[model samples]
Every structure is written in C-alpha cells, then in structure tokens.
Target: IRAHHADLAKLLTSVKGVGPTTASTLLAQLPELGKLNRKQITALVGLAPMNRDSGTLRGQRHIFGGRADVRRVLFVAALVGTRFNPVLKAFYARLLAAGEPKKVALVACMHKLLVILNAIARSKSPWSNEIATVV
Candidate 1:
C-alpha cells in the first residue's frame, strides 16, 4: 500500500490510533473516504444514526445498514483512540459525563473519528491535535 498509495497511507496513519492495518482496511474497503462529505462517509460506514420514529411514536436513533467490515475496523480504532488520542479521549469522557452509555459513547467516538479522518483526507493533510479538535 505504501508503495502505491503512499499519500493516503501517510495521511490515514497520521492519526494516533490508526495503525497500518486500520489505514489499509479503510483504504481498501472505503475508497470513498476522502471524496465524500461527513454525512455520506458516516452513513457509508454505518456510523450515522438513523431515526426510528413513526408518525405518532418517538423512537431512539440507531445505526444500521452500512459496511460492517469498515464499522468493525473503526470500532477497534475508536477503542484505542479513547485511550491514546487526546481529542478522542476528551470527547469520550465528555460523552460519558453527559450520561451516554459506554457503548453509545464509543460509537459516538467512532463517528467523530471517521469525520476527522474524512476531513483530513479531503484536505490532503495529516492529523494534528489542533486540527482534529477543530474537525
């Protein structure tokens, strides 16, 4: 991958939690990562929350129906991110403090991590704590 997609590999691995395997998986499985908007990217990876409400019934928003493989890779990445990535670590803590369940917060962190990666890819930039925080 580095021989062919050096730029992408470098960009993806710039993030603290995204190792070579995670970056490669993303590059292979989610070719649209940099090309799409945040919403599109999240939906593609099954990280976007879907509304379950009906005409007269309010329901919780849940995620479903996207690339399970990408989602699985992101789950592992997010777990590491919560501990090592300062931005993600803070985000996870904040979510937990706000009463979100551990799993829910982790999912949210995954969503956020994807968004940050998408932004980085789109801008052709490497990850930085300041830039990631803004994203």
Candidate 2:
C-alpha cells in the first residue's frame, strides 16, 4: 500500500505495533484483510502462539512459532509501544497483572495493535501520533 500511497506508510508507524518493519511486513502478509477476522489477523502477524503438548511435558503454550520475520518486527514495535503509547502501556500493565508472561502480554498487545492497523487500512484513514489520542 505504501509503495503507491506514501501517506499510509506515514500513518502506519504512528500506531503501536507498526514500525517501518512491521508496517511493511503487514502489507506483504495480509495483502487482503477485507476478509480477515482477529484470528486470521493474529496468524498473519505471527503472534499466534501454538499449543503443543505430549504426556509428561504439557508444553505450556509459548510463542516459538509464527512468521519469524513478521514476529521480529512486531515484537520491536510492541516494545516501543509499551514504553511510549498510552493505551498500549495500560493494556500491557493489565495483561501483566492478569498473570500472563511478559512475552505473552507483549504478543497480546501486538494482536491489538495489528487489529487497529487493519481497521485503519479498511477505513482508508492515515495515522498521526499527534492524533493517536483521539482514536
């Protein structure tokens, strides 16, 4: 989208989990979100932790899966958000209080950020940090 639409790129990074890397990655993976729900969104961003278990191990869900490239970028954007974005800061703190692991909480945050990005794309709006609070 950003190739032809410089504005979307400018708008995207202003969102929580959308840095240059994630903004680009999302454009590639979720080429058509006109049909994705939150679940599909999660899978695309590679934030969906899988549940794998055997007999003795139980494998307590973790996030060693999903698209590594996308995950890499989203994770970085998520870290930035936790420190800088107000809504995400609160959301991260809430998830931590709920006893989720730090990594998991961050992933949850990424999921939310991705959803917002999708909405922006669908709605044909651009983002600006100055106006982030209004959203």
Candidate 3:
C-alpha cells in the first residue's frame, strides 16, 4: 500500500514533533512524485519558496499554505530543527538578522530541512552537514 511514504517516515524519525502520526499526515497531504515535479511537490507541501515577481512589488519567499494540518506539524518540527540541525541553526540565525519574523525564519529553516530530506531520500544517505560537503 503506497508505502513510499515510508521514506518520509524514516526522515522524520530524527526530527521533532514528527511522530508516526505527524509523518503520516505529511505523506498523505504532499503530492505524489508522479503528480508533480520536485519543485512543485515541495510547493504542494508548503515547503517551497514563494516569489512576488512584479514591478517594485518586492519579491519574498513565502511559506507553503497548502495544508494547515501538515503545516502545523511542520511548524513544531521546524522549531526543533533550528535548535538541533546544524544547517538549520545557521539559516535560522541569518534569516532572523534579515528582519524576517521568528516564525518565518523558522519556516525558512524548515524549507531547508525539507530540501535536505529530498536529497537524503534520493541518495539513501544519512544526514550530513554542509561542513562535510565543503570539507
């Protein structure tokens, strides 16, 4: 039974506020890979960047608004992610200095976390740091 959601399950194990139930909800709500491109899938899950492309409108990366239930769990996980995930901690601090709301900064960190998960699932590797990538 469509157990690819198990990939999400595995990733969530190390994240906070992401027990089986929360991970299950995320999988249920996110787009199936066949239904959308990777970018689109991230957007559908409310994890992609948003742009306000127009004359002097000021483009910004807005958060996923696709599913409230899914987003709620993500918020909690995102909070914890900032504290524990090395990459997310740096991102969160940078975003905060840029004057983004605390919650918004947390959400941006969440997006980075999701992107990392996407790669981890594709590569079948455990989480590693940007430091590792660079060194």
Candidate 4:
C-alpha cells in the first residue's frame, strides 16, 4: 500500500493513533475524503447525528446509514485518539466533564477526528496541532 502512493497515506498516518491499517482503510473506503466538506464527509461516514423528531414530540438524534467499515475504523481510532491525541484527548475530557455519556463523547471525537482528517487530505498537508482546534 505504501508503494502505491506513499504521500497521502503517509500524511494521514502522521496523526497519532492512526496506524497504517486505518490509513489504508481510509484510502480504500473513502476516496472522496479530500473532495468533500465536513457535513458531507461526516454523513458519508455515518457519524452525522440525525434527528428523530415528529411533529409534536421531540426525539433523540442518532446516527445511521453510511459506510459502516469506515465508521467502525473511525470509532476505534477515536478511542485511541481520546487517549493519545492531545486535542482529541482534551475535547473528550471536556465532553465527559460536561456530563456527556462516554459513548456520545467518543462519537463526537470520531466526528471531529474525521473532519480534521478530511481537511488535511483536502489540503495535502501533514497532520498538525492546528487541526485539533478545528470543529
């Protein structure tokens, strides 16, 4: 995989917690990563929360229906991110302190991680601390 096109994969793996497997999974499963905006990318990865409200009753928002493989990989990556990646670690801690459920906070981290990855890919830049502050 590294021999195929090393730069993009290398750029992605520069992020802490995203290993070669996750990077390749991203390359194969999400060829559109760099081409789309945050909302579009998050929805594509099934990380965008969808509201389940009706006319009279408000329902909880939940995420569903997108690339399951990508979502799964992101979930795992986000789990590692909450421990190792500084920005993500801080964000996850903040959410937990605010009383968000562990799963909800992890999902939020997944969303933010994906958005930062999308932006990095779009810009053809290696991972940086600045991406952490975004979203």
CA-only RMSD, every prediction: 1.4, 4.0, 3.9, 1.6
Residue 86 deviation, candidate 3, in Å? 1.6
TM-score of each: 0.94, 0.73, 0.68, 0.94
Q: What is candidate 2's lDDT per residue for 85-107, written digit by digit as tens?
A: 88789889999999999988988
User: What does candidate 3 score on TM?
Assistant: 0.68
How many pairs of residues collide in model 1?
0
Order candidates by lDDT, high to low.
1, 4, 2, 3
Better of 3 and 4 by TM-score: 4
Of the candidates numbered 2 and 4, which has the greater lDDT value? 4
lDDT of 4 by residue, 4-100 (tens): 4478889889988788888989999998988999999999989999999889999999999999999998899999999999999999999999999
Give the C-alpha miss distance for residue 110 in model 3, angstroms: 1.8
Query: What stretches of model 2 exceed 4 Å from their correct place?
Result: 1-3, 33-35, 53-59, 127-135
Select the stronger candidate by TM-score from 2 and 3.
2
In angstroms, give how far residue 119 of model 2 lies from its true place. Answer: 1.6
Enumerate residue pairs that collide in model 4. Answer: none
Of candidate 2, the 10-residue stretch with the lowest lDDT total is 126-135
- Rate residue 119 of model 4 by lDDT: 88
